[model samples]
Target: MKNMNIQVKGTIAPGYGVASGKGGDSRFPQGTIEMQKPFFQELGLDLSPYFSGTLNISIHPHRYRVKSFKYTFINVKWSSIQPAEDFSFADCRILFNDSSFEGLIYYPHPDTKPDHFQAADILEVIAPKIDGLKYGDELILECDRTQIDIVIVKKFWKY
Candidate 1:
């Protein structure tokens, strides 16, 4: 377990809305939760300790290394209630100003994801909800570099 500090700066933004039930696939949240249950269970992780939904951040011009790993693919089967889907996740520590939270970064299989989510600058972070944060706010996230196997994938553009 090699630990390296990774720092990311970005502005808060609204995502697909599926996590908050505002729009998109209505069953997405439930399906994601269900799909993640067993994986977390196997790790002896308690889901009850965290909040549901993700914090979307948009980073433009700025580039940060993306860490990768051998992740388990979660198959969310479609039932009479919802559509089928696949999801993947990686664990990381999120640094927000003076606060820090342990969380997962979810990556939905490309075939099953919305176009807007495929942006290189957009990141979906799931953690216990943080208060006093709003859209357009700048934030910094620090995590172990090995967790995501990150490498700089883009060049920084001047605004």
Candidate 2:
């Protein structure tokens, strides 16, 4: 067997909130940050063939391209929710669909690697507002996990 070293250069596609208000964005003392409140949504973890495993399978330096998968949530009147009525909600994050989202790149692939890593090549939306908003009714979404094809250079660094 050969050494499995998968170098995943992952990224998290930026996402926008879908809510009944006037969208999300805020200007702070420094600059600005987009704030969004989605009406609601339901997302399930699905990893089929072509890329299915325990996230610990052996591979040599692999990079995965992740796109922002969106799923429609609740549909309010768009007038009920106030733009800045202080819904007492948390915040979220944004990312790209390429080698941008640095937080989602799990090198060893397993959460239980021999060397505990503080970082991984995995993309995710942090602390999204998807709990007690008004998300309900029907839902529709399209998602996929494609392998990021890139040239790998295996050169000796030290003698």
Candidate 3:
């Protein structure tokens, strides 16, 4: 069956910088993705094509939940100092300035992740490095409705 797709308007927002290790976190100096790539590769998912850092997108007044997923890696023991974590991914497309780029919805299951909590309205995306993208820029994000569900939590002037 063909997957249903949902598109929503989002804004590029800044994250805690923990994913790319720019937050000065001593434990993950090389970034979380860099540390986890080999483990994911071992599990048969090659994340080498995507950027090392995540693109934080905010769909304010709208929260999200993963109803299904394209890929899920369970109990990934990427760090020696930290506990194993589960991760899920869903196919996504980011459109900005009339350009579209393929990406993945990077979901680190909160039940396993120890720290760096993200808001319900924020989505962490991984894609090829796009030039000229900056914080506060508006973009359209498309995701598989079956994999990721987005809904308006509050009607705040119809954002």
* Top of the candidates by TM-score: 3
Q: Best candidate, lDDT-wise?
A: 3
The alpha-carbon root-mean-square deviation between model 3 and the true structure, to one decimal in Å, is 3.3
Error of 1 at 136 (Å): 1.1
1 versus 2: better lDDT goes to: 1
Count clashing pairs, candidate 3: 0
User: How many residue pairs clash in each candidate at the backbone level?
Assistant: 8, 17, 0
Task: Name model 3 segments beyond 4 Å from true.
Answer: 1-3, 155-159
**What TM-score does candidate 3 reach?**
0.93
Q: Which candidate, 1 or 2, would have the higher TM-score against the true structure?
A: 1
RMSD over all Cα atoms, model 1: 4.3
Over 1-159, each residue of candidate 3 has an lDDT whose tens digit, in order, gives 235789899999999898888989999888998898899899988999999989999998788888988999999999999999999999899998899898999999999999999998999999999999999999999998988899999655855
| Superposed model 2: Cα runs more than 4 Å off | 1-41, 44-53, 61-147, 156-159
Candidate 2 RMSD to the correct structure: 17.7
Number of backbone clashes in candidate 2:
17
Work out the TM-score per prediction.
0.71, 0.19, 0.93
